[model samples]
Target: MKALVTTEDSGFGLRMADVPEPEPRPGQALVEVRAVAVNRGELSMMAMLPPGSQLGWDIAGTVLRPAADGSGPAAGTRVTGLADGAGWSELAAADTARLTPVPDDLDWTAATAIPVVGLTALYALRHAGLLLGRTVLVTGAGGGVGRMAVQLAAASGARVVAWVGSAERAKGLRELGAAAVSTYDAEETGPVDVLVDSVGGQVLNRAYRLVVPGGKVIVYGNTTRSELNLPVDWGHARPGVQLRYVHLFHELPAHPVTRDLGFLVQRVADGLLDPQVATVAPWTDAEPALRALAQRQVNGKVVLTI
Candidate 1:
Protein backbone atom coordinates (compact mmCIF):
# COMPACT_ATOMS: atom_id res chain seq x y z
CA MET A 1 0.00 0.00 0.00
CA LYS A 2 1.17 3.51 -0.81
CA ALA A 3 0.85 6.28 1.74
CA LEU A 4 2.24 9.73 2.47
CA VAL A 5 4.88 9.56 5.18
CA THR A 6 6.78 12.27 7.05
CA THR A 7 10.29 12.78 5.75
CA GLU A 8 12.92 15.44 6.43
CA ASP A 9 13.94 15.41 2.78
CA SER A 10 10.66 16.77 1.41
CA GLY A 11 10.03 20.52 1.49
CA PHE A 12 6.70 19.98 3.26
CA GLY A 13 8.06 17.03 5.27
CA LEU A 14 5.82 14.49 3.51
CA ARG A 15 6.48 12.03 0.67
CA MET A 16 4.77 9.00 -0.81
CA ALA A 17 6.13 5.62 0.23
CA ASP A 18 5.09 2.00 0.01
CA VAL A 19 3.97 0.79 3.40
CA PRO A 20 2.28 -2.31 4.79
CA GLU A 21 -1.51 -2.20 4.73
CA PRO A 22 -3.30 -1.34 7.97
CA GLU A 23 -5.09 -4.02 10.00
CA PRO A 24 -8.44 -2.94 11.40
CA ARG A 25 -9.30 -3.76 14.94
CA PRO A 26 -12.65 -5.14 16.02
CA GLY A 27 -14.13 -1.68 16.44
CA GLN A 28 -12.52 -0.27 13.31
CA ALA A 29 -13.42 -0.35 9.62
CA LEU A 30 -11.00 -0.54 6.69
CA VAL A 31 -11.69 2.26 4.23
CA GLU A 32 -10.39 2.42 0.68
CA VAL A 33 -9.68 6.13 0.58
CA ARG A 34 -10.72 7.99 -2.55
CA ALA A 35 -9.86 11.50 -1.31
CA VAL A 36 -8.10 13.12 1.65
CA ALA A 37 -8.01 16.69 2.96
CA VAL A 38 -4.75 18.41 3.79
CA ASN A 39 -4.73 20.56 6.89
CA ARG A 40 -2.38 22.99 8.64
CA GLY A 41 -2.43 20.77 11.74
CA GLU A 42 -0.82 17.91 9.81
CA LEU A 43 2.12 20.15 8.87
CA SER A 44 2.60 21.08 12.52
CA MET A 45 2.52 17.40 13.51
CA MET A 46 5.26 16.55 11.04
CA ALA A 47 7.61 18.72 13.05
CA MET A 48 7.12 16.49 16.11
CA LEU A 49 6.60 13.03 14.56
CA PRO A 50 9.45 10.83 13.43
CA PRO A 51 10.26 10.27 9.78
CA GLY A 52 8.10 7.63 7.99
CA SER A 53 5.19 8.14 10.35
CA GLN A 54 1.80 8.30 8.61
CA LEU A 55 0.13 11.69 9.20
CA GLY A 56 -3.34 12.59 7.96
CA TRP A 57 -6.77 13.02 9.56
CA ASP A 58 -9.53 13.79 7.03
CA ILE A 59 -10.51 11.04 4.59
CA ALA A 60 -13.52 10.15 2.41
CA GLY A 61 -13.98 6.86 0.64
CA THR A 62 -15.78 3.50 0.44
CA VAL A 63 -15.77 0.91 3.17
CA LEU A 64 -13.65 -2.05 2.06
CA ARG A 65 -14.47 -3.89 5.26
CA PRO A 66 -16.92 -3.19 8.06
CA ALA A 67 -16.03 -3.10 11.72
CA ALA A 68 -15.48 -6.61 12.99
CA ASP A 69 -17.74 -5.82 15.97
CA GLY A 70 -20.65 -5.04 13.59
CA SER A 71 -21.09 -1.55 14.97
CA GLY A 72 -20.48 0.67 11.91
CA PRO A 73 -21.56 0.96 8.29
CA ALA A 74 -21.78 -2.09 6.02
CA ALA A 75 -19.10 -2.91 3.49
CA GLY A 76 -19.09 -0.76 0.32
CA THR A 77 -20.79 2.14 2.11
CA ARG A 78 -19.52 5.55 1.02
CA VAL A 79 -18.26 7.49 4.02
CA THR A 80 -16.22 10.42 5.30
CA GLY A 81 -14.21 9.84 8.48
CA LEU A 82 -11.52 11.08 10.86
CA ALA A 83 -8.36 9.01 10.63
CA ASP A 84 -5.88 8.43 13.45
CA GLY A 85 -2.81 9.63 11.55
CA ALA A 86 -2.99 7.19 8.64
CA GLY A 87 -5.65 8.67 6.37
CA TRP A 88 -3.22 9.60 3.56
CA SER A 89 -2.93 5.94 2.61
CA GLU A 90 -5.01 4.21 -0.05
CA LEU A 91 -6.44 1.99 2.71
CA ALA A 92 -6.79 3.35 6.21
CA ALA A 93 -8.40 1.91 9.32
CA ALA A 94 -10.91 4.23 10.98
CA ASP A 95 -12.66 3.65 14.26
CA THR A 96 -16.41 3.08 13.90
CA ALA A 97 -17.10 5.87 16.34
CA ARG A 98 -15.60 8.48 13.98
CA LEU A 99 -17.01 7.29 10.65
CA THR A 100 -20.04 9.01 9.06
CA PRO A 101 -21.90 7.83 6.00
CA VAL A 102 -22.02 10.36 3.17
CA PRO A 103 -24.70 10.69 0.52
CA ASP A 104 -23.88 9.19 -2.88
CA ASP A 105 -24.38 12.59 -4.51
CA LEU A 106 -21.72 14.36 -2.40
CA ASP A 107 -18.47 14.99 -4.17
CA TRP A 108 -15.40 13.29 -2.70
CA THR A 109 -13.59 16.62 -2.23
CA ALA A 110 -16.47 18.12 -0.27
CA ALA A 111 -16.94 15.01 1.81
CA THR A 112 -13.28 14.84 2.78
CA ALA A 113 -13.38 18.49 3.92
CA ILE A 114 -15.97 17.94 6.66
CA PRO A 115 -14.33 15.96 9.46
CA VAL A 116 -11.91 18.40 11.06
CA VAL A 117 -12.96 21.80 9.72
CA GLY A 118 -16.73 21.42 10.10
CA LEU A 119 -16.62 19.78 13.51
CA THR A 120 -14.25 22.41 14.86
CA ALA A 121 -16.61 25.23 13.91
CA LEU A 122 -19.68 23.35 15.19
CA TYR A 123 -18.19 22.48 18.56
CA ALA A 124 -16.55 25.85 19.08
CA LEU A 125 -19.83 27.71 18.55
CA ARG A 126 -21.62 25.21 20.79
CA HIS A 127 -19.24 26.10 23.59
CA ALA A 128 -20.11 29.78 23.25
CA GLY A 129 -23.68 29.24 24.43
CA LEU A 130 -26.46 31.18 22.60
CA LEU A 131 -25.31 33.18 19.58
CA LEU A 132 -28.64 34.76 18.66
CA GLY A 133 -28.41 38.58 18.44
CA ARG A 134 -24.80 38.55 19.60
CA THR A 135 -21.60 39.69 17.95
CA VAL A 136 -19.11 36.96 16.92
CA LEU A 137 -15.55 37.52 15.77
CA VAL A 138 -13.77 34.82 13.75
CA THR A 139 -10.02 35.22 13.36
CA GLY A 140 -8.30 33.61 10.40
CA ALA A 141 -11.68 33.84 8.73
CA GLY A 142 -10.27 33.09 5.29
CA GLY A 143 -9.21 29.55 6.20
CA GLY A 144 -11.35 26.43 6.09
CA VAL A 145 -12.42 26.26 9.73
CA GLY A 146 -12.76 30.03 9.88
CA ARG A 147 -15.03 30.06 6.84
CA MET A 148 -17.21 27.39 8.43
CA ALA A 149 -17.22 29.30 11.71
CA VAL A 150 -18.40 32.48 10.01
CA GLN A 151 -21.29 30.71 8.29
CA LEU A 152 -22.36 28.74 11.37
CA ALA A 153 -22.25 31.79 13.61
CA ALA A 154 -24.26 33.83 11.14
CA ALA A 155 -26.78 31.00 10.80
CA SER A 156 -27.21 31.10 14.56
CA GLY A 157 -28.27 34.77 14.16
CA ALA A 158 -25.01 36.30 15.28
CA ARG A 159 -23.44 39.29 13.54
CA VAL A 160 -20.20 37.81 12.25
CA VAL A 161 -16.99 39.86 11.90
CA ALA A 162 -14.38 38.06 9.79
CA TRP A 163 -10.67 38.84 10.22
CA VAL A 164 -8.41 37.74 7.42
CA GLY A 165 -4.71 38.27 6.68
CA SER A 166 -5.16 40.20 3.47
CA ALA A 167 -7.73 41.84 1.21
CA GLU A 168 -7.33 39.23 -1.51
CA ARG A 169 -8.37 36.44 0.88
CA ALA A 170 -11.44 38.42 1.93
CA LYS A 171 -13.40 37.60 -1.22
CA GLY A 172 -16.75 35.74 -0.96
CA LEU A 173 -16.73 35.82 2.85
CA ARG A 174 -19.49 38.44 2.98
CA GLU A 175 -21.73 36.21 0.85
CA LEU A 176 -21.08 33.38 3.31
CA GLY A 177 -22.74 35.46 6.06
CA ALA A 178 -20.02 37.67 7.40
CA ALA A 179 -21.40 41.07 8.26
CA ALA A 180 -17.98 42.66 8.03
CA VAL A 181 -14.64 41.35 6.75
CA SER A 182 -11.47 43.05 7.97
CA THR A 183 -7.81 42.44 7.45
CA TYR A 184 -5.12 42.49 10.15
CA ASP A 185 -4.76 46.26 10.16
CA ALA A 186 -8.47 47.04 9.96
CA GLU A 187 -9.84 49.04 12.85
CA GLU A 188 -12.60 46.81 14.25
CA THR A 189 -14.19 48.28 17.34
CA GLY A 190 -17.03 47.37 19.68
CA PRO A 191 -17.16 44.26 21.84
CA VAL A 192 -18.02 40.79 20.66
CA ASP A 193 -19.94 38.20 22.66
CA VAL A 194 -17.72 35.38 21.47
CA LEU A 195 -14.41 34.96 19.67
CA VAL A 196 -13.33 31.98 17.54
CA ASP A 197 -9.60 32.28 16.93
CA SER A 198 -7.33 29.88 15.00
CA VAL A 199 -4.53 32.25 14.12
CA GLY A 200 -2.81 32.62 17.45
CA GLY A 201 -0.15 35.10 18.63
CA GLN A 202 -0.98 38.78 18.31
CA VAL A 203 -4.36 38.18 16.67
CA LEU A 204 -5.53 36.12 19.62
CA ASN A 205 -4.21 38.63 22.13
CA ARG A 206 -6.05 41.42 20.34
CA ALA A 207 -9.28 39.44 19.86
CA TYR A 208 -9.44 38.34 23.49
CA ARG A 209 -9.57 41.98 24.51
CA LEU A 210 -12.59 42.49 22.23
CA VAL A 211 -14.71 39.88 24.03
CA VAL A 212 -17.22 41.56 26.31
CA PRO A 213 -17.55 40.61 29.94
CA GLY A 214 -19.09 37.16 30.38
CA GLY A 215 -18.02 36.34 26.83
CA LYS A 216 -15.87 33.39 25.71
CA VAL A 217 -12.81 32.93 23.52
CA ILE A 218 -12.39 29.51 21.94
CA VAL A 219 -8.88 28.66 20.77
CA TYR A 220 -8.51 25.73 18.39
CA GLY A 221 -5.43 25.94 16.13
CA ASN A 222 -2.36 28.14 16.60
CA THR A 223 -1.35 28.45 12.95
CA THR A 224 1.26 31.09 13.65
CA ARG A 225 2.90 28.79 16.26
CA SER A 226 3.79 31.71 18.47
CA GLU A 227 3.66 32.01 22.24
CA LEU A 228 0.70 33.79 23.83
CA ASN A 229 1.36 36.79 26.00
CA LEU A 230 -1.71 38.33 27.59
CA PRO A 231 -1.89 41.38 29.77
CA VAL A 232 -1.09 40.93 33.43
CA ASP A 233 -4.40 42.61 34.40
CA TRP A 234 -6.47 40.01 32.51
CA GLY A 235 -7.69 38.30 35.66
CA HIS A 236 -8.65 41.49 37.42
CA ALA A 237 -9.94 43.56 34.50
CA ARG A 238 -11.89 40.81 32.76
CA PRO A 239 -13.84 39.16 35.53
CA GLY A 240 -16.27 36.91 33.67
CA VAL A 241 -14.28 36.29 30.52
CA GLN A 242 -13.50 32.66 29.67
CA LEU A 243 -10.76 31.15 27.53
CA ARG A 244 -11.09 27.61 26.21
CA TYR A 245 -8.77 25.30 24.29
CA VAL A 246 -10.63 22.88 22.07
CA HIS A 247 -9.15 19.73 20.51
CA LEU A 248 -11.35 17.30 18.60
CA PHE A 249 -9.89 14.21 20.28
CA HIS A 250 -10.58 15.67 23.73
CA GLU A 251 -14.14 16.63 22.78
CA LEU A 252 -14.88 13.49 20.73
CA PRO A 253 -16.34 11.57 23.69
CA ALA A 254 -18.46 14.54 24.77
CA HIS A 255 -20.49 14.37 21.55
CA PRO A 256 -20.97 11.62 19.00
CA VAL A 257 -18.47 12.26 16.18
CA THR A 258 -20.62 10.32 13.73
CA ARG A 259 -23.71 12.38 14.53
CA ASP A 260 -21.94 15.71 14.18
CA LEU A 261 -20.39 14.59 10.90
CA GLY A 262 -23.81 13.57 9.58
CA PHE A 263 -25.21 16.98 10.47
CA LEU A 264 -22.40 18.70 8.57
CA VAL A 265 -22.77 16.47 5.53
CA GLN A 266 -26.53 17.04 5.47
CA ARG A 267 -25.99 20.79 5.69
CA VAL A 268 -23.67 20.61 2.70
CA ALA A 269 -26.24 18.57 0.79
CA ASP A 270 -28.93 21.14 1.59
CA GLY A 271 -26.66 24.00 0.44
CA LEU A 272 -26.63 25.46 3.92
CA LEU A 273 -22.90 24.83 4.27
CA ASP A 274 -19.97 25.06 1.91
CA PRO A 275 -16.81 22.92 2.03
CA GLN A 276 -14.82 25.68 0.23
CA VAL A 277 -12.34 23.48 -1.56
CA ALA A 278 -9.53 25.71 -2.91
CA THR A 279 -7.40 23.08 -4.56
CA VAL A 280 -8.10 19.60 -5.97
CA ALA A 281 -5.28 17.48 -7.35
CA PRO A 282 -3.98 13.93 -7.45
CA TRP A 283 -2.06 12.65 -4.44
CA THR A 284 1.09 12.79 -6.53
CA ASP A 285 0.92 16.58 -6.14
CA ALA A 286 0.68 16.52 -2.34
CA GLU A 287 3.84 18.51 -1.83
CA PRO A 288 2.70 21.56 -3.77
CA ALA A 289 -0.73 21.45 -2.19
CA LEU A 290 0.78 21.28 1.30
CA ARG A 291 3.21 24.04 0.51
CA ALA A 292 0.41 26.25 -0.71
CA LEU A 293 -1.54 25.63 2.47
CA ALA A 294 1.47 26.21 4.70
CA GLN A 295 2.30 29.47 2.97
CA ARG A 296 -1.28 30.69 3.15
CA GLN A 297 -1.50 30.78 -0.63
CA VAL A 298 -4.96 29.17 -0.59
CA ASN A 299 -7.98 30.25 1.43
CA GLY A 300 -9.86 26.94 1.80
CA LYS A 301 -9.49 23.18 2.17
CA VAL A 302 -7.07 21.42 -0.19
CA VAL A 303 -8.22 17.97 -1.33
CA LEU A 304 -5.87 15.26 -2.61
CA THR A 305 -7.48 12.49 -4.64
CA ILE A 306 -6.14 9.07 -3.75
Candidate 2:
Protein backbone atom coordinates (compact mmCIF):
# COMPACT_ATOMS: atom_id res chain seq x y z
CA MET A 1 0.00 0.00 0.00
CA LYS A 2 1.16 3.54 -0.77
CA ALA A 3 1.28 5.71 2.36
CA LEU A 4 2.39 9.21 3.23
CA VAL A 5 5.55 8.89 5.25
CA THR A 6 7.88 11.29 6.97
CA THR A 7 11.22 11.81 5.24
CA GLU A 8 14.30 13.58 6.55
CA ASP A 9 15.48 14.92 3.18
CA SER A 10 12.09 15.98 1.75
CA GLY A 11 11.49 19.73 1.85
CA PHE A 12 8.11 19.21 3.49
CA GLY A 13 9.37 16.40 5.71
CA LEU A 14 6.90 14.08 3.98
CA ARG A 15 6.88 11.80 0.94
CA MET A 16 4.99 8.86 -0.50
CA ALA A 17 6.31 5.36 0.10
CA ASP A 18 5.12 1.81 -0.28
CA VAL A 19 4.38 0.17 3.06
CA PRO A 20 2.87 -3.10 4.24
CA GLU A 21 -0.90 -3.13 4.76
CA PRO A 22 -2.18 -3.01 8.31
CA GLU A 23 -3.98 -5.97 9.87
CA PRO A 24 -6.91 -5.58 12.22
CA ARG A 25 -6.39 -6.50 15.85
CA PRO A 26 -8.89 -8.09 18.24
CA GLY A 27 -10.81 -4.82 18.82
CA GLN A 28 -9.79 -3.01 15.64
CA ALA A 29 -11.12 -2.88 12.08
CA LEU A 30 -9.09 -2.67 8.88
CA VAL A 31 -10.32 0.21 6.77
CA GLU A 32 -9.64 1.01 3.12
CA VAL A 33 -9.05 4.72 3.53
CA ARG A 34 -10.86 6.89 1.01
CA ALA A 35 -9.98 10.29 2.42
CA VAL A 36 -7.86 11.86 5.14
CA ALA A 37 -7.76 15.29 6.77
CA VAL A 38 -4.63 17.39 7.40
CA ASN A 39 -4.16 19.04 10.77
CA ARG A 40 -1.60 21.63 11.90
CA GLY A 41 -0.53 19.57 14.90
CA GLU A 42 0.41 16.56 12.78
CA LEU A 43 2.24 18.76 10.30
CA SER A 44 4.23 20.41 13.08
CA MET A 45 5.44 17.05 14.33
CA MET A 46 6.51 15.77 10.92
CA ALA A 47 10.17 16.66 11.36
CA MET A 48 10.39 14.81 14.65
CA LEU A 49 8.65 11.62 13.52
CA PRO A 50 10.76 8.52 12.82
CA PRO A 51 11.68 8.16 9.16
CA GLY A 52 9.08 6.34 7.06
CA SER A 53 6.44 6.59 9.79
CA GLN A 54 2.82 7.06 8.65
CA LEU A 55 1.29 10.42 9.57
CA GLY A 56 -2.38 11.35 9.99
CA TRP A 57 -5.18 11.10 12.53
CA ASP A 58 -8.54 11.65 10.77
CA ILE A 59 -9.82 9.24 8.13
CA ALA A 60 -13.03 8.31 6.30
CA GLY A 61 -13.41 5.08 4.37
CA THR A 62 -15.05 1.66 4.02
CA VAL A 63 -14.52 -1.18 6.45
CA LEU A 64 -12.78 -4.00 4.61
CA ARG A 65 -12.75 -6.20 7.71
CA PRO A 66 -14.55 -6.17 11.04
CA ALA A 67 -13.01 -6.39 14.49
CA ALA A 68 -12.02 -9.87 15.60
CA ASP A 69 -13.99 -9.39 18.84
CA GLY A 70 -17.23 -8.66 16.89
CA SER A 71 -17.51 -5.24 18.46
CA GLY A 72 -17.52 -2.99 15.39
CA PRO A 73 -19.47 -2.50 12.19
CA ALA A 74 -19.37 -5.42 9.77
CA ALA A 75 -17.16 -5.52 6.73
CA GLY A 76 -18.31 -3.33 3.79
CA THR A 77 -19.77 -0.68 6.10
CA ARG A 78 -18.76 2.96 5.53
CA VAL A 79 -17.02 4.57 8.47
CA THR A 80 -15.08 7.61 9.66
CA GLY A 81 -13.06 8.10 12.81
CA LEU A 82 -9.83 9.07 14.54
CA ALA A 83 -6.71 6.92 14.35
CA ASP A 84 -3.55 6.97 16.42
CA GLY A 85 -1.55 7.24 13.19
CA ALA A 86 -1.08 5.62 9.74
CA GLY A 87 -4.36 7.08 8.41
CA TRP A 88 -2.42 8.67 5.55
CA SER A 89 -2.12 5.24 3.94
CA GLU A 90 -4.51 3.34 1.70
CA LEU A 91 -5.25 1.04 4.60
CA ALA A 92 -5.41 1.77 8.34
CA ALA A 93 -6.24 -0.19 11.47
CA ALA A 94 -8.91 1.71 13.44
CA ASP A 95 -9.99 0.97 16.97
CA THR A 96 -13.60 -0.25 16.88
CA ALA A 97 -14.60 1.94 19.78
CA ARG A 98 -13.41 5.06 17.92
CA LEU A 99 -15.05 4.31 14.57
CA THR A 100 -18.28 6.04 13.52
CA PRO A 101 -20.57 5.11 10.66
CA VAL A 102 -20.64 7.65 7.85
CA PRO A 103 -23.94 8.60 6.26
CA ASP A 104 -24.51 7.07 2.85
CA ASP A 105 -25.06 10.45 1.24
CA LEU A 106 -22.04 12.18 2.72
CA ASP A 107 -19.00 12.57 0.51
CA TRP A 108 -15.64 11.22 1.61
CA THR A 109 -14.16 14.75 1.77
CA ALA A 110 -16.91 15.97 4.10
CA ALA A 111 -16.95 12.86 6.26
CA THR A 112 -13.18 12.93 6.69
CA ALA A 113 -13.37 16.46 8.12
CA ILE A 114 -15.59 15.45 11.05
CA PRO A 115 -13.52 13.12 13.19
CA VAL A 116 -10.74 14.97 14.99
CA VAL A 117 -11.90 18.58 14.74
CA GLY A 118 -15.57 17.79 15.30
CA LEU A 119 -14.86 15.68 18.37
CA THR A 120 -12.51 18.32 19.74
CA ALA A 121 -15.12 21.07 19.44
CA LEU A 122 -17.83 18.89 20.97
CA TYR A 123 -15.69 17.78 23.86
CA ALA A 124 -14.41 21.28 24.54
CA LEU A 125 -17.92 22.68 24.77
CA ARG A 126 -18.90 19.86 27.07
CA HIS A 127 -15.92 20.59 29.29
CA ALA A 128 -16.89 24.25 29.51
CA GLY A 129 -20.35 23.29 30.74
CA LEU A 130 -22.05 25.09 27.85
CA LEU A 131 -25.70 26.00 28.55
CA LEU A 132 -28.57 27.54 26.63
CA GLY A 133 -28.59 31.35 26.47
CA ARG A 134 -25.06 31.55 27.82
CA THR A 135 -22.36 33.62 26.15
CA VAL A 136 -19.50 31.61 24.57
CA LEU A 137 -16.25 32.97 23.17
CA VAL A 138 -14.16 30.93 20.71
CA THR A 139 -10.62 31.92 19.73
CA GLY A 140 -9.00 30.97 16.41
CA ALA A 141 -12.48 30.73 14.92
CA GLY A 142 -11.18 30.56 11.32
CA GLY A 143 -9.57 27.14 11.76
CA GLY A 144 -11.28 23.72 11.60
CA VAL A 145 -11.94 23.09 15.28
CA GLY A 146 -12.66 26.78 15.85
CA ARG A 147 -15.23 26.94 13.05
CA MET A 148 -16.95 23.81 14.34
CA ALA A 149 -16.96 25.26 17.85
CA VAL A 150 -18.68 28.40 16.58
CA GLN A 151 -21.49 26.52 14.86
CA LEU A 152 -21.93 23.91 17.58
CA ALA A 153 -22.02 26.51 20.33
CA ALA A 154 -24.68 28.47 18.47
CA ALA A 155 -26.73 25.34 17.72
CA SER A 156 -26.71 24.67 21.43
CA GLY A 157 -28.29 28.12 22.02
CA ALA A 158 -25.21 30.01 23.21
CA ARG A 159 -24.34 33.48 21.96
CA VAL A 160 -21.02 32.97 20.14
CA VAL A 161 -18.21 35.52 19.84
CA ALA A 162 -15.59 34.42 17.32
CA TRP A 163 -12.00 35.68 17.15
CA VAL A 164 -10.12 35.28 13.91
CA GLY A 165 -6.84 36.56 12.47
CA SER A 166 -8.27 38.38 9.44
CA ALA A 167 -11.44 40.22 8.43
CA GLU A 168 -11.73 38.24 5.20
CA ARG A 169 -12.02 34.97 7.12
CA ALA A 170 -14.65 36.48 9.41
CA LYS A 171 -17.14 36.98 6.55
CA GLY A 172 -19.33 33.91 6.96
CA LEU A 173 -18.73 33.30 10.65
CA ARG A 174 -21.88 35.20 11.55
CA GLU A 175 -23.94 33.21 9.04
CA LEU A 176 -22.56 30.11 10.75
CA GLY A 177 -24.17 31.42 13.99
CA ALA A 178 -21.52 33.62 15.55
CA ALA A 179 -23.14 36.62 17.20
CA ALA A 180 -19.94 38.58 16.69
CA VAL A 181 -16.75 38.00 14.72
CA SER A 182 -13.68 40.12 15.31
CA THR A 183 -9.95 40.04 14.63
CA TYR A 184 -7.71 38.64 17.34
CA ASP A 185 -6.40 42.13 17.99
CA ALA A 186 -9.87 43.50 18.63
CA GLU A 187 -10.86 44.20 22.20
CA GLU A 188 -13.36 41.85 23.85
CA THR A 189 -14.32 43.42 27.14
CA GLY A 190 -17.52 41.67 28.05
CA PRO A 191 -17.45 38.63 30.28
CA VAL A 192 -18.36 35.29 28.72
CA ASP A 193 -19.99 32.26 30.34
CA VAL A 194 -17.61 29.91 28.56
CA LEU A 195 -14.35 30.31 26.61
CA VAL A 196 -13.20 27.69 24.07
CA ASP A 197 -9.63 28.54 23.14
CA SER A 198 -7.64 26.77 20.43
CA VAL A 199 -5.00 29.48 19.89
CA GLY A 200 -2.74 29.68 22.85
CA GLY A 201 -0.18 32.28 24.07
CA GLN A 202 -1.63 35.79 24.29
CA VAL A 203 -5.06 34.84 22.98
CA LEU A 204 -5.55 32.16 25.62
CA ASN A 205 -4.47 34.54 28.34
CA ARG A 206 -6.84 37.25 27.11
CA ALA A 207 -9.80 34.91 26.73
CA TYR A 208 -9.20 33.39 30.15
CA ARG A 209 -9.56 36.79 31.78
CA LEU A 210 -12.96 37.29 30.11
CA VAL A 211 -14.61 34.20 31.57
CA VAL A 212 -17.25 35.00 34.16
CA PRO A 213 -16.46 34.46 37.82
CA GLY A 214 -17.83 30.95 37.93
CA GLY A 215 -17.45 30.18 34.24
CA LYS A 216 -14.98 27.75 32.66
CA VAL A 217 -12.12 28.20 30.19
CA ILE A 218 -11.05 25.19 28.15
CA VAL A 219 -7.64 25.25 26.41
CA TYR A 220 -7.06 22.69 23.66
CA GLY A 221 -4.33 23.85 21.24
CA ASN A 222 -1.20 25.94 21.17
CA THR A 223 -1.05 27.04 17.57
CA THR A 224 0.54 30.44 18.02
CA ARG A 225 2.84 30.19 21.01
CA SER A 226 4.59 27.06 22.20
CA GLU A 227 4.90 28.54 25.66
CA LEU A 228 1.65 29.87 27.08
CA ASN A 229 1.88 32.67 29.57
CA LEU A 230 -0.99 33.50 31.89
CA PRO A 231 -1.67 36.56 33.96
CA VAL A 232 0.23 36.64 37.23
CA ASP A 233 -2.96 37.16 39.20
CA TRP A 234 -5.12 34.69 37.23
CA GLY A 235 -5.64 32.32 40.09
CA HIS A 236 -6.37 35.02 42.62
CA ALA A 237 -8.41 37.33 40.38
CA ARG A 238 -10.89 34.62 39.35
CA PRO A 239 -10.90 32.13 42.15
CA GLY A 240 -14.26 30.70 41.14
CA VAL A 241 -13.35 30.42 37.45
CA GLN A 242 -12.32 26.91 36.42
CA LEU A 243 -9.36 26.40 34.07
CA ARG A 244 -9.15 23.11 32.19
CA TYR A 245 -6.89 21.74 29.46
CA VAL A 246 -7.94 19.07 26.97
CA HIS A 247 -5.74 16.61 25.10
CA LEU A 248 -8.20 14.59 22.93
CA PHE A 249 -6.13 11.40 22.88
CA HIS A 250 -5.96 11.34 26.67
CA GLU A 251 -9.70 11.79 27.10
CA LEU A 252 -10.85 9.25 24.48
CA PRO A 253 -11.21 6.47 27.04
CA ALA A 254 -13.45 8.54 29.32
CA HIS A 255 -15.69 9.69 26.46
CA PRO A 256 -17.47 7.66 23.82
CA VAL A 257 -15.52 8.53 20.65
CA THR A 258 -17.76 6.48 18.35
CA ARG A 259 -21.02 7.85 19.76
CA ASP A 260 -19.83 11.48 19.64
CA LEU A 261 -18.45 11.19 16.11
CA GLY A 262 -21.67 9.46 15.00
CA PHE A 263 -23.82 12.30 16.36
CA LEU A 264 -21.72 14.92 14.50
CA VAL A 265 -21.88 12.87 11.31
CA GLN A 266 -25.69 12.77 11.59
CA ARG A 267 -25.77 16.52 12.16
CA VAL A 268 -23.77 17.05 8.96
CA ALA A 269 -26.08 14.70 7.06
CA ASP A 270 -29.10 16.70 8.28
CA GLY A 271 -27.48 20.00 7.15
CA LEU A 272 -27.47 21.27 10.73
CA LEU A 273 -23.62 21.18 10.84
CA ASP A 274 -21.06 21.91 8.15
CA PRO A 275 -17.70 20.17 7.90
CA GLN A 276 -16.39 23.34 6.18
CA VAL A 277 -13.99 21.71 3.72
CA ALA A 278 -11.56 24.40 2.56
CA THR A 279 -9.54 22.36 0.10
CA VAL A 280 -9.71 18.92 -1.54
CA ALA A 281 -6.68 17.57 -3.39
CA PRO A 282 -5.40 14.18 -4.38
CA TRP A 283 -3.05 12.43 -1.99
CA THR A 284 -0.28 13.01 -4.55
CA ASP A 285 -0.44 16.70 -3.64
CA ALA A 286 0.15 16.01 0.03
CA GLU A 287 3.31 18.12 0.07
CA PRO A 288 1.69 21.34 -1.12
CA ALA A 289 -1.42 20.73 0.99
CA LEU A 290 0.74 20.24 4.08
CA ARG A 291 2.78 23.34 3.21
CA ALA A 292 -0.37 25.45 2.94
CA LEU A 293 -1.65 24.09 6.23
CA ALA A 294 1.64 24.88 8.00
CA GLN A 295 1.53 28.41 6.62
CA ARG A 296 -1.94 28.87 8.11
CA GLN A 297 -3.43 29.68 4.71
CA VAL A 298 -6.43 27.37 4.97
CA ASN A 299 -9.65 28.69 6.50
CA GLY A 300 -11.23 25.29 7.20
CA LYS A 301 -10.51 21.58 6.94
CA VAL A 302 -8.23 20.35 4.12
CA VAL A 303 -8.92 16.84 2.80
CA LEU A 304 -6.67 14.64 0.70
CA THR A 305 -8.46 12.03 -1.40
CA ILE A 306 -6.95 8.60 -1.66
Which candidate leads the pack in lDDT? Answer: 1
lDDT (CA) for every model shown? 0.90, 0.87
Q: Which segments of model 1 are wrong by more than 4 Å?
A: none
Q: Model 2, range 112-143, lDDT digits (tens) per residue?
A: 99988998889888887746989999999998
Candidate 2 overall Cα lDDT vs. reference?
A: 0.87
User: Can you give the TM-score per candidate against the true fold?
Assistant: 0.96, 0.96
Model 1 per-residue lDDT tens digits across residues 202-267: 988887777777888899988888897677776667788899999877888899899989999989
- In candidate 2, what residue range of length 10 has the lowest lDDT sum? 182-191
Per-residue lDDT value at 102 in model 2 = 90
Candidate 1 structure, TM-score to reference: 0.96
